[model samples]
Target chain A: MSPADDPCIGDVSEGHILRAILARTPAAEHALLGPGDDAAVIAAPSGSVVVTTDTLVHGPDFRLAWSSAYDLGWKAAAVNLADVAAMGARPTALLVALAVPRDLRVSFVEGMADGLRDACAALAPGCAVVGGDLTVSSVLTIAVTAMGDLEGRRPVTRAGAEVGDVVAVAGELGQAAQGLAVLFGRFRDGDDPVPVDPAQLAAGERLALNAQLRPVPPIGLGPLAAIAGATAMMDVSDGLAIDAGRLAAASAVTIALESRALGADPARALAGGEDHALLATFPSDGPLPPGFRAIGVVQPPREDAPVTCDGIAADPAGWDPYRDWDATAG
Target chain B: MSPADDPCIGDVSEGHILRAILARTPAAEHALLGPGDDAAVIAAPSGSVVVTTDTLVHGPDFRLAWSSAYDLGWKAAAVNLADVAAMGARPTALLVALAVPRDLRVSFVEGMADGLRDACAALAPGCAVVGGDLTVSSVLTIAVTAMGDLEGRRPVTRAGAEVGDVVAVAGELGQAAQGLAVLFGRFRDGDDPVPVDPAQLAAGERLALNAQLRPVPPIGLGPLAAIAGATAMMDVSDGLAIDAGRLAAASAVTIALESRALGADPARALAGGEDHALLATFPSDGPLPPGFRAIGVVQPPREDAPVTCDGIAADPAGWDPYRDWDATAG
Candidate 1:
C-alpha cells in the first residue's frame, strides 16, 4: 500500500507505522519541543526530576502472535510509568525506542502507537512523544523511558516503613497474572490453540486477558498516597508477596498480611504479578484515604520469617525467572 | 563472588539485581516518594518535563571483545546524556534497563556500574540512577532514559534559526569518527585480525580507538551556549554536513560553511559522526562565547543547495543506518 493509504490492518512496515503514530500526537501545553528533535524539552518547575527506563524483548517476555503491537506499546509505557510512579513521582513525559524486523507490517506499528497514546493519556498529563531511534533487529524489542517531577516533597523510600505502619494497596491485585493465565490457555488443560469455538472462553477471562495486555498503573495514587502520609510505597510489578518481602527487607521490619482481607482468590493476589497496583505503608494512627484498603501490618522482625499471613509463616512463593514454572506446577 | 563480599552490589540473580539498583536510590528532594511502591511520586516544578530514551545493542553498537564493560557503560550513558544536552537542558537523572546472558560475570556488571558512576560524575551532577528492569537475553543490551531541567529557559530548537544568523560550534569535532576509523582497522588495510606487532598501532591511533570506545560528550557546553544567547542548537551525532542540512531545513534557511575555517582534513570533519559537539546559531552581531568558534553563516535559501562549503555545494554524507559501510566503500 502507498504510505498515504492505510496498509491492510496488520500489514505495514514499522517505520511507516511510527510516522503515522507520530502524526497523530497532539501538542501538549508544557511541551516546548516534542518528537523530531534530538530530545524532547519540557518545563521543569523545581530544577529537579526523576527518570527511569525499561526494555521488553520478544520471546522471553512476549509473543507477537498472541499480542497486538498496540498492546506491546501500551505495556512498554505502563511498565516504565509504573517505575516512575513507584518513586512517588508524577510522570510528565516519555521516550520510546523500538527495534523490529524490516518485514513487519506498518499496521502493527500503528497499533503499537495507539497503545502508547492510550497508556500515556491515562498515566501522564501533558505527556508527549519525544525522540527515538529505530532499528531492525532479529526480534522486536521495545525500550521506554519515563520522566517525573516531585513538587518539593521529601521522597518516601522503601527504607522508611517503621514498625507499626499499616500496609495498604490502591488498585486491584493479581488481575494481570489471571489475565496471562487466560491468554496462554494455562488455566485449562488440553485446550486447543485454535479452538473450534473461540467463545468458549468466559467474558471474565477476556477481561483478564485485556488486563495482561494493557496494565493500567495507578499513577495519581502515588503522589496522593505521599501527600496522605504514606511511610513507603511501591508499584507491584512482581507478585504482591515477593514485592512485599522486598519492602520488609528494605525497611528492616517484618510484615504480616491478613490474606483473608484481600479480594477473591487470595492465592492469585499473593503470587500473581504485573498488577501495577500501589502497595503503601501508612502510620497506624494516620487516616486512611478512600480507595486504599489495609491488608497488612509492619512489625519488628520475628524469628526466621520476614513476612507472614494470618499468624502463620507464608512461603515466599512467586515467579522465579531461573526456575521452570511447569515443573513447579506439577 | 559471594553476595556477602559485595553487599552493595546485591544478589547477582536477575531479580536481585533489580532490587539492589532500586534500593540505594533516594527519593529526589522534590520527590513525594521514590521507587519501592506501586508508582513513584514527583512534584512537577512547572507541571512538565522533557524525556528521551535510547538502546545500545551489542555487536551492532559495540563488541565485548574491543570494549570493556565499563567503556560500554560509559558510552551508553554519554549517548543518552548528549541527547538531553542537545536540547539545551541540564540533565537531572537517569533510568537504565539492562538485559544480559545469565552466564556473564559479576565483575563485568560491576564495571558497568563504575562506568555509569564516572559518566554521571562528568556530565550530570546529583543525577540519580533511579530505577530499571533486568531480564535474560541472548545478547547484552542497555536501555537508558535521561531527563532534563529546562529551568524556564526558552529551549533552543532546530527550527528557530533564521537567515543571517551566525553558525558556531562548541566541543571537539571528528574525534569519535577518527577513533572509529582506527578501531575498524580502516587505517591499515588487509591487516591480520591480531596485529603482527603490538606496538605497530601508534599512540594517537590508540587514543582514537579509546575515543570511539568511550565518547566523552561536551555536556556543559550545550547549556552554556543556551545561556550565552544561542538561538538554535543541536548535538552533532551525525556528520556536520548532513545534520547542518537538517537544522537549515528546520529553520527554512540556507547555511554556508567556510572550508578553510574547518581546520585539518576538512572532509573528515564534515563527514564524521558521533562527535557529541553542540552546533548552534546566534545573531550574527552578537558576541560569541570563549570556547565557541564561528563555522558558517545562515542565509536565505539559494538555488544551489541548502548547505554549501566555501562557496561550493557539498554532498550530505554521514552514517546511514540502512546502508552498510562496506557496501558503500566498494
Candidate 2:
C-alpha cells in the first residue's frame, strides 16, 4: 500500500502536532544512560533487570473526544514511566509500538511522537525511542516498554515494609484523581466539552487532567529515596490507601495513616491515585528527604485489621476495573 | 479488581508462562538486560541512536487459528528485531507491551512470553525484557521496542546502493510466502483448515513457517556486510523484488537480475518476503561474504525501467498490506 493508504496517515501538520505534544513533557538528566540512543544504556549496577509491559487501547482507556493526540501520547508514555519508577529505579529509555486504523490523520501519529518525546524529556531525559513496528489495526492502541537503571541499590519491592517505619509521600496526590473525575463528568457531564473558564482549567483541575493524560512520574525520587535510607518505596499509580494495603500485606505489617496530616481533603487524597508520586517508608527517627512529606507510619499488624487511620480501621477506597464505580457511589 | 476482573488477567499460568516466554528470548551479553533484573542495561556503542516504533493487532496481522500466544510473542519480537537489523545494527535488548482481554487464557499470555523468549534466544542473545505496562483491552495486541548497538559502524541505509554493485542475499526466501499460502488456504481452499503434513512439508517450507512465526534475523550481518565494503544493506521483510526496487529508487540506480542464473522458480523467492534475511550490494568483483549468495547486479537506469531481469523489464512482485496477490500460472 502507498504511504497514504497506511492507516496512520492524515493531513495534520506533523511539526505542529509534535510541538503540541511535547509541550507537556518533563526534562531529561544525566545517569539516563542513552536517552536518545538507539537503545538506552542504563547502569544496571545490580546485575539484574526488572521489566514489565503495558498497552493502551483506544475507546477503553482513553477517548478521542476529551483528549488530544498529544495527550494520548503523553499518557501512554507516562503510564509506562510510572511503572518503572514504581520499581524504585530510575527510568532510562523507552520503546513504543503503535497500531492505528488506516483512516487516522497523520497529525495524530506526530502528536503521539510528540507525547513520547515530552514524557522522555521530563522523566527519563535522554531516553531514546529505539525500534518499533507499525501496521493497520481496527482501532488505535499503543504499547510501550520502559528501561531503567537500579544504580547498585536493592530494588525496593512492595514486600519489604516493616512493622514500624514512617510512611511519607514525595509528590502531589489526588490531583490526577480529581482530574479524572472532572474529565469523565464525575463532576459535570453533557456540558461544553472544553471548560468555559480558562482560570478554572488552569487551577489544579487542568493539571490533574494533564496528570491523567501525561503523568510526570517522580522518576529520580524513587532512587533518591532508596539512597536516602528509605526502607520501601513505590510510585502511587493506585490510590494510596489500596496501594498502602498492598505494601502492608507484602511486608506483613500494619500501616496506620494519620488522615488529618494529609494535605487538603484527606479522604479524596487517600483514595485518589494516578499522582505519579512516590510513597516510601523510613525509620521513625530517620530524616525525611527533600520533596517528601510525612503522611503516616507503619505499625504492628492487628489481628483483624492490616491497615488503619490513627486508631480507626480503614477500608480500600480506590477504583476497581471490574466494578461499576458510579453505581457503587452514594 | 481481583486479578480475575482485571482485563489483563488470562488463563495462562503465570510462572510457566513467563518462563516459557523468557526461554525463547535471547540473552544480552554486555550486561543482564532481561526480565528478572531490576532494570536491564544495554551497551550503546554509538553516540547517536536511531529509533522507530510499530504495533501488531490481532485478527488483522495474525489469526488465533494459526498462531498460539507464544507464536504471537515471537512474531512481535521478530518484526521489531528485523527493523533494527535492517538499520545495520546488533540488537541489544527489547521492551514488550501487551494487552489482553480478561477472559483470555493466562496460558496464552505466558505462551506469548515464551515466544518473546524464543525469538530472543535465536536472534538477540542476552537481550532482556526491561520494562513495560500491562492493561486490559477488548482485543489482543502486542507492542515491542527493540534497542541495538551500531558498534561504530556506519548505518547501511536504503539510500546507499549505486550502479555496478552486485546484489546478494544471506538467508532463505519465499518459504514464508509458501507457508502463508498453505496456512491461509491460498493454495488450496477447503471446509477445514489445511492440515500440515509433517512429512510432506519441505525443510524450506518448515523453515519458512518458522521464520514467519519467529524470524531469526541475521542480526549482525547488516553491519558486517557494511564492514566488508558492501554499498547498501537491509533485511528482506518484504519481497526481494519490491525491496530491491526501493533500494534502486532511493540510490537513483537501476537493478538488473540474471533470471536464468537465479534457479527455477526464482520469482517465488524474489517476490515473497518475511524472510528477515539480509540483502546487500557490493562491487562486482568483491568477494561475497560467507553466508551470502550473489543474486543480481546494479546497472545504469533505463528510461522506462527501474528494475529488470534477463534484459527484459519485470513487474514489481512484493507483498502489499492491502492488496491481494495474483500468482502467475506455472
Candidate 3:
C-alpha cells in the first residue's frame, strides 16, 4: 500500500510498521543478535568499545520538506559513524531511537532504513543497524548511538595534541556549511524546503546541496591516522576554530593555522562545520598519511588565546542550530 | 543556581550549559574515555556487548509537571538498564540524547543528569553517563542507549523456553499500571501535570504512583537468573500477558498462568505493564532463582492460543500509549 493511503504510521499499527522495516534490515555479519528481542548483542572482541550518540530534530536538524527520508537516514547514520571514526575505531553497529508523527509515511520509514543500510554498506561494510526503538511523537526525531571496535589500539582522543605537532585533516573541508548556505539562499523566503532534483542543478549548486543533505565523511582514515602515529584527533563537526580550540584547550596547546595551506577558501576551512572530516595532530617528525594534508601546527600554550590563523585571531563561528532557530524561522 | 530564574537554557548558551553539566558527571570506572570528546571508550573485556534503546517523549511518555527532572532521569536509566538485565548483562555505560525546548531550564538538564548519576550510583554503580548530545526541540525528549558487558555468558533470549518450564518473575508486577491509573484518576481534568508529595498519600496509593513515576527494576537478578539457568527471559515493559505471549510465541510453546499463584488481583498481574521485572522460564527440575516467584508453567503448543490464565483464554490488552493519544487530547 502507498504511504498516502492506509500506509501512514498513524493509520497503521506499530507492530505492522516494525515488521515492514524489519524485512528490509541489511545483513549484519558482525551482529551477534539482531532486532526483535529485548536487546541486540554484538561482538566487542577488541575488549573495548567506542560509543557516542546524536539526535536530529525535525526543525533544528533537518526539514523534511527539503530532505527526503532517504537523505535523513543517510545523514543520521553518517553523523553517528563519524563520531565512531573520530575515536579511531571502526564503527560496527548502531542502535536507533526513532520518534515519528503518526502522519509520517510508511515509505518514510523504509526509505530511512534503506539509507541506513546503504550508508553502512558504502561507508563501514561490517557496521549494521543492530537494534532500534520506534515510538509516536509530534515531530520526527532520530537519536542514534554508534559503537565501534578499537581493534585493540588506544583511542585517539581530542586531548592528546602536543606543542610542535602538525595539525591535519583527512576529508572534505567546509563543504557541508557551504551546502547549508546554498540551501538557505535557495530557500530564501524560508517558505520552500523542497529543492529541484539535485541532478538538474548546476554542478557547484548540486555539490553544495548534496553536502547539506548527505554528508559522507572519510571513515577509513581515522584508524589509519591512529596507526600512523597521530597523537590527537576529532571529527570537524562544529567548525574548525571552535573544535580546534577545544582540542587545543584540552591539550593545553595553541593551534596556528596557515591560511594559504587551507585551500583557496581559508575562512570556510577555519569557520565552517559539519564536514565530519578527521582533524588530527601528529608529531611534526611523523608522516602525513594518504588523504591527509597538513593545515596547521600546535604551539606552546599562549595565555591570551588557544587558536590562531597565521598571526591574526580567527573567529570560530560554528553552526549552532539552537541559536539559528532561536533568532528566527529557518 | 536554581533552575527557575537564571538558568533557563535559552538564557545561557549551549557551550556554557554543556560545561556546567560536564562538571557534575560522576566517575565512571568502566569508561576508558568519558565525556568531553568525540566519543567515549567503554571497557568491553567481554567479546560481546548488549545494546538497547528507549525514547521517552514529553507528553506521550511523561509530563514535566507530574515528573521532576530527577524522576525522569531515574526512570529513563531504570528502563534501559532493565533491558540489559533481561539479557543477563551488566550495563556498563549509557549515551543519552536529550532534546529540549530552548525555554527549558539549564537546571532541568543538570537535574536530569543528576537523576541519571544518582540512579547509576544507587542502582547500577559503574554504569556511567559517558557521552551524550544536547539539542533544541519543541519538546523535551530523552532517548538513551545502554551498553552492557555480558561477562562471557550466553544471553538468555526469549526463544529458548522448553515445554514444562516454570514461569517466574523477579520484581514487582501490575504496580506501575495501577500507579498510572491512579495519577490519571487524580488528574482527571489533566490540567495539573504536577502532583503533591506522594509521601502524603496512603501507602497503597503512594506505591502505585511511585511505580508509575520511578521504576526500580531488580537489576542484580538478571545475571543471577542466567547463572541459575533461565532458559528464556524478557523484561515486563509491556503487560505480562502481552509480553508472555511474546515469549510463548517465540519459544513455540504455550505459557499457562495459575491465577492463585500471582498474588492478589490476578488481572493486574496479567494485564499491567511497566513493572520492569524479569520474567523468565526455567527448567521445571531446576530450582527457581532467588527473587523470582513461579506463576505459570510452559506447556506444549495449544491450538486455541499462545497464552492463557487458569485454563481460560486471556486477552492481551496492555498499555498502548500511541492509541491513547491518537484518539484525543495532548
Best by DockQ: 3
Worst lDDT window (10 residues) for model 3 chain B?
B321-330
Q: Residue-wise lDDT of candidate 1 within B139-213, one digit each (tens)?
A: 577878776666567677888888888999877677778877765664334431222233756787766676677
Candidate 3 falls in which docking quality class? medium
The local distance difference test score of model 2 is 0.65
A229 Cα displacement, candidate 2 (Å): 5.4
Candidate 1, residue B177: the lDDT equals 83
Supply every candidate's count of residue pairs whose N, Cα or C atoms clash at under 3 angstroms: 37, 65, 2
Per-residue lDDT of A1-330 in model 3, one digit per residue for the tens? Answer: 753554778778677888877788875777899888899998888898898999889888888767889999999999999999988899999888999887778888999999888888888888989989998788788998999999989999988998889999888777888888776666645554565556556887678678778888989888898888889999988888988888988899999889988877888878788878899999998689898999899999886778889867678677654355532133
| Per-residue alpha-carbon lDDT of candidate 3 for residues B63-101, written as tens digits (9 for 90 to 100) | 776789989998999999999999999899888899888
**What residue runs in model 3 are displaced by over 4 Å at the alpha carbon?**
A1-6, A190-200, A319-322, A326-330, B1-5, B190-200, B326-330
Evaluated on the second chain alone, the candidates' TM-scores are 0.86, 0.82, 0.94
Select the stronger candidate by DockQ from 1 and 2. 1
TM-score of chain A of each: 0.88, 0.81, 0.94
Relative to the real complex, the DockQ score for model 3 comes to: 0.69
| lDDT per residue as tens, model 2, B180-257 | 765665323343334455676677767767766666667656667767877777677678777777677767888788
Error of 3 at A270 (Å): 1.2
lDDT of 2 at B40: 43
